[model samples]
Target: MQKLLASCIFFMLLAFGSCTQESDTPILVSTEDLLFVGGDKVRISGRLLTNQDVLATDHGFLFSTESSFAGAQTLSLGQKNGPGRFIGESTGFKIGQTYFAKAFAEINGQRIEGDVVELKTLTPSVSSFTPTYASAGNEMVIQGKNFPQGTKVFFGTQEAQVLQNLFESKLTIRIPVAAGQVVVPVKLVIQDKEIVLPQPFEYQAGKYTKVSEFPAQARIYDNTFFTNSSGFHVGLGRLRLSDSYRSFQRFDPTNGTWTEINFPGNPRRFAFASSSYLGGGALEVDRDVFQFDRSFYKINGSSFERLPDLPFNTREAMAVDWNGKLFLFGGRDGAGSVVREYDAIGRTWSQKRPAPFDMSGTTAVFKYGERIYVLAASGQVWEYLPSQDSWLTRGTYPGNTGQGFPFAQVIGKKAYLGLYRRTQEIWELDLETGVWKSKNQIIGLPQSINAGHFQSNGMIYILRSAEESTNGVLPMELYKFEPDAI
Candidate 1:
């Protein structure tokens, strides 16, 4: 009897060890992300350990997992003709609904599971939220939440603002600017509800602050703070945390940090820019562009307004406000060239000038003694003096630069530039002597191929690259730099 019991225990331990070995292999064919917001797709791809075998789901996305879940997803499967390539689709997937999924195959009668993925379907939305009657221009901020990004918002007759529009349980809109108390039944054509403030606000003057010695193109606002690509306010001292997307996160200098209120926009898009102006001896700030859906909205520190279009689409270009005029320059586009100038005062794009020779991997900021100083991809620098109205060649970038540039912006008197391809080093510019300096040797940057990358101010941002670069790194969350000693 004792011998028989010991044998049974031995077999059980062996079986468990085999199971652990199978789970250790990470060979998987999967979508880009496990859980997806509505209207997003997950790219299912991976390898199957060279020889083994390949199996995919044919019906709904159904897979068993100990951890991780993708709501309900419709999934299909296919084989790899290449090394680790896979093909498949999740069937009957709603846009914003969430679900979990996994891939597995039976080998020698034992089932093996792959990576766990999750997905979410988009929620239904009320398309229109309009106000009628009374005054205040029938203004309404049709508060729409949990809806897919492309879902539209409408006010009475006009289409509601999109792209760079605020998201959350609340979104404000100006109907037509009316006079008295207006009552318009809130209606939504594509969303869940029309958002009307329970108590309408009376038009009143706003109080702002005056900030100086900051970079013009680097983002300076008096009574205002900047928003991240996420379209939320990085309320200076309010939110002790700062976003790498914005040049300088305006904070309450008196308190140090404040709770950041996320502005309702995609932080990854380049459509957002800020400027500061003096009004009645006070400094005022506003964001004039939101690039995601091509919407141009202006907002003071307290509220927002829909503004007009930029002279042209620009990424990596910096905006400067001077004597009531705006200047923009030094960023890449699909065609690959930095913008020279956009006379917002004249509403025109001046003839393209000699932008930074290396258009990509560049940054620009307004310096005290010069126009706007430009940093280039190859560690090159240029100065734009508005008074001279010409581009001056400056010193070379002092740090590592990449040709696959993503973003670069300035803060305070300093300028920061990020290299594309997710390299850890960031190049900076010294406003005092017009010299380039490299700050922070990012040690923990994610290893990815083709992925999102950006840089700004004192912070350095690197991310998990979804695609392959020289290294096989997967895309993940954004990484902030913690300098070693420099």
Candidate 2:
């Protein structure tokens, strides 16, 4: 009985030992986890399980677009001698696509594979872009996710230069030249997928043409400018402290020519001149001492009819014509905020309400509707109601005033202001809504000052003179501004 019992126990122990030996796999592979996933690449972590050190001729991962592993791509890890965790990476995968992956190992010419795992590549998308408005050659950045290699950007039909792409995201590109269009849609093409950005990009749309050189060949500064039925006229400014240019020149937009016109009144500098009236200036200079001129006149088609001389004298005063009356505001010589009115019927000058701040001929003032909008050097936009003779702060000027002396020309209901001394910036102000928008900067001569400006038929004509520091280096030029042009 004892022998029979011992035989049964021995058989049972042998069976248990056989089961343990069969359970010890020589080389086993497991698809542990996906370490990372990207637009076109993925890193997979895999494990090789074995009871003892087993030589694996090859170990790696398999990736394929099909679940059946047909036409699968292999990421071989060469060879392995021990059982442990292994990692492999596969690239050149399609973005926003689903793929199947599995870990595998080869031992003794036999193949071992783990369970297949499914993953989807990240989709490429754009979030936003900076600087909706830019000029050609300006750098702009696009923020997004999963921007694959060989991504293309376009501004309308023009292809932009790609500067840099970071982390398969965030693209920096150079703005392309505008193809005679002010605003254009921005688009991106990635891997045959086209994307149009929500907001369209605007190109700097100002075209500057040197219409003609100043025929006077003399740099004019602090001059008087006016426009009438005939044309635009500019004159009456000092070439130096003791020398002044009294020659008035007329520019005809119809023929694109300039003609020197005659003024019967004595020549003077720092005078106030509007459409039909001219008065008050510093005239004769004796050893650098100025004598103010108070003679007034009414201009009528190349002829001047003398009117009553001004009651007081001031230099560089702002003048405008409204309701058949000549209105002047501010000047040098302690007349900073004074407002004076001369009625054509009465032929007499009367003092009106004072301006809100100091104003001069250099201050940018334009007539829109029934109000005179004054742009102060301090970036304040003052609205003056000519009817009520009252003033109110409308809004703030956004552009740089620089050394002051910016020009304001109104065409229709829009006012174009800027080109302040030593600055090339120009801004457009909506007289009706009081909203300001930045326009394209002037083409050249940033260190230039405005000599005179007048508008005709929705186009603004400007005369540019060099600043004092840049005198003689930059020629006095006439520019025709198509405010709404591309």
Candidate 3:
């Protein structure tokens, strides 16, 4: 009986030794069948090769631009079943970019990585196509990646004539004349692969036409304008001789006439204005600085009342009203990207997040929908989210940034922008798509600098003064612009 017990104990020891040997074996992982699923996307398949009593606690594919796996992005297949095949997917790969990927598994507490596999994503893609609305004979540029020498482009079923295949990423093509106002797909075909832009391009129907001119005395540059319930107000500008004026005026679109109004504050330059949250045709003005006075004021009827002073001296900053609060962004405070917010009702000032970049001479700051936008002198466009108190770089402005102050006014879903530096060209930007279209040049108005732009009752008004001044005053003129008529 003792001998039999010894033999049984020996058999149990053998079974235990076998189990420890199997669990101590190292795990093997490998990646296979990396396939291109289309633009900027790929499918990765991987498998574990070792069998163990404890399944893999973690398994997935690791990928990155570099092979070191430092700062690499991981696709986690959490608690995956071991010794079997698993699949994972990744996206947002740049066109024509090479990536390194490896399969990994964690068993018991050890992480085991597989051999690195190299992958190259397909290059054919379209980043952006300009002139969303165009006419036949209009030149359009398709910007993207991986355009082979013989790649073909199409607008709907009509093929566009390629004017210049400049590079692998840029193609200049003349739009084919199509039926007016027809929405059509823009297609790019390379080899056997084809890509269609998500947003269809529209063929424009109307052309730019001249409208009535501004009926008031033209004000010099740095003039302030804001829209109110009654009409639009224009006032407070620097003369050509560097002297400031307090003459204020308002335009009534209903009668197409301008009336002089009392401006109670001392003449100020670079004063920013916005429609007053309080009613009765009142407007708010801030950053008013000239010779002796630098304060905030509210224009109520013929009287101007002082408000709380700005936290700091700010000039040339962009101001916009959001939900009854005033937000000032990037001006001449020596702070590269300063952003300040004011609660008019509470008479309090608070600093928000700065802009993404310096906005010293921003062309325009206006609100559309829930977001506020800033167009800087360097042609960079940024969007500010009040809820997030953060800024996002919205594509660059695709217009001529000449030596003039940037002026922009939003009317509906479109914003009209132009530089006053001897440029007759006006650009229309679709706020929804961030696409810019060059409209017809302003006619019946002389080229001027530091012009003020304001929109009221669906009509855009451009206030300009003579470039050359007589005595200290510049000949001022205001022109009414009807975009649809153009």
Candidate 4:
């Protein structure tokens, strides 16, 4: 009996040892992916069981340049739950974008990946809005809300003169003063359809209320945002990769306009191999190098040049700047990974705390004083301490919105993000507290495939596919999200 038991134990140990490997090949989890929406943080949960000490990629977004909040995409491992269940959250999603996720698990140096999951990005806001003080019809300058530039606002039965627009959401105009209560119902006309605001205002007072006294049709949430999608003060907002193609634009909420910038030669600038060039001022400036090269690079306006690269090749990794050194995970594509380092000034790569899993496309956002948040593709979320390059998996992407926001671009102390494949929408993740609170969604372009490259300079642009289906052909016209006031 003792001999038989020993044989069984030996077999079990061998089996578990063989399963602990890493893999870069994608998993095929269905595309019913999770979707994160609203200004509230959501959750995603799952399960995993393995007798091996395996590490692998789970979920995250890639195509860095396309994401308005593009940072590092992520990879994740399942957490222990209910003997089998695991959970996660897509904490830093950008609005108006779509995304897909996957998972991998390994035991004893043998790795296996999960399937892919896909989901659509949601509109920045559910409705368009306008604020006016004019009574029924005369003519009122209806300050637009939740509006993309070029959006038309109406004053009841009469079309108000759109004198000027500030930010895609703010507008100024004179009500026709047709002669009534000086108050009126405002509506937004889009696609030839009329949407009356739920809240009404009175122009009688001869003043406009931007946030308060909004009509029923006004978009309720109004988180401030700037061009960077990270508005602690500059209106930094949740940055969403508006298009799959390369393009840059900014929406000025102060003046409704969609400003455009020349496309960058480095379209996928957010790749793990490219993290070194985030600039010396960035929060994750790696002091130590990884697998790429010892030199790093930077995004100078709209170009890329030779800089330091990590000594090792990495994928779906997380990063942070500590004592001027970039502490990072040398995640494996699938062959079990390591945690490498890079020196910015010295221009060299070194070693540090290795990651718990082989990861890629993970997001690094911070709550400033509290901690730096790390999210992964496999729905793994954790906080990293620069003092110790270690990780503690918090949870999974909130909800099954496979289309969760994956970028976390900071503006001052605030962090903003954009969801994949979404037309116009952003989410704000406060870095001071590690909690998520969303604001108003932007109304930019319509959701389409490969929409990571869409950028806005106060003016949002949407290009219809000229090669989609038979009757789906549309012109690649530049539709100004919201033109600026002149």
TM-scores of all predicted structures: 0.35, 0.88, 0.54, 0.34
Q: Write the per-residue lDDT of candidate 4 for residues 283-302, one digit (tens) a residue.
A: 11245433232334443433
Q: Which stretches of model 1 miss by more than 4 angstroms?
A: 1-272, 275-294, 311-324, 330-369, 406-420, 427-429, 434-438, 448-486
lDDT of 1 at 406: 34
Q: After superposition on all CA atoms, what RMSD does each candidate show versus the true structure? A: 28.4, 6.7, 20.4, 34.4
Off by over 4 Å in 3: 1-218, 277-292, 301-303, 444-446, 468-474
Residue-level lDDT of model 1, residues 163-245, one tens digit each, is 34454334455544322222223334434434433333332111112221121212211112233433223222111112324
Q: For residues 164-243, write the lDDT of model 3, one tens digit per residue.
A: 87646789999997743367888887666679987898775324332334443444556667767666677776555556
Winning candidate number (TM-score): 2
| After superposition, candidate 2 runs with Cα above 4 Å error | 1-24, 240-242, 432-435, 444-447, 468-475, 484-486
lDDT of 2 by residue, 375-411 (tens): 8877788998988989999888798878778888888
Question: Cα lDDT of all candidates, in order?
Answer: 0.41, 0.83, 0.69, 0.39
Top lDDT model: 2
Ordered by TM-score, highest first, the candidates read 2, 3, 1, 4
1 or 3, greater by TM-score: 3
Candidate 2 Cα lDDT to native = 0.83
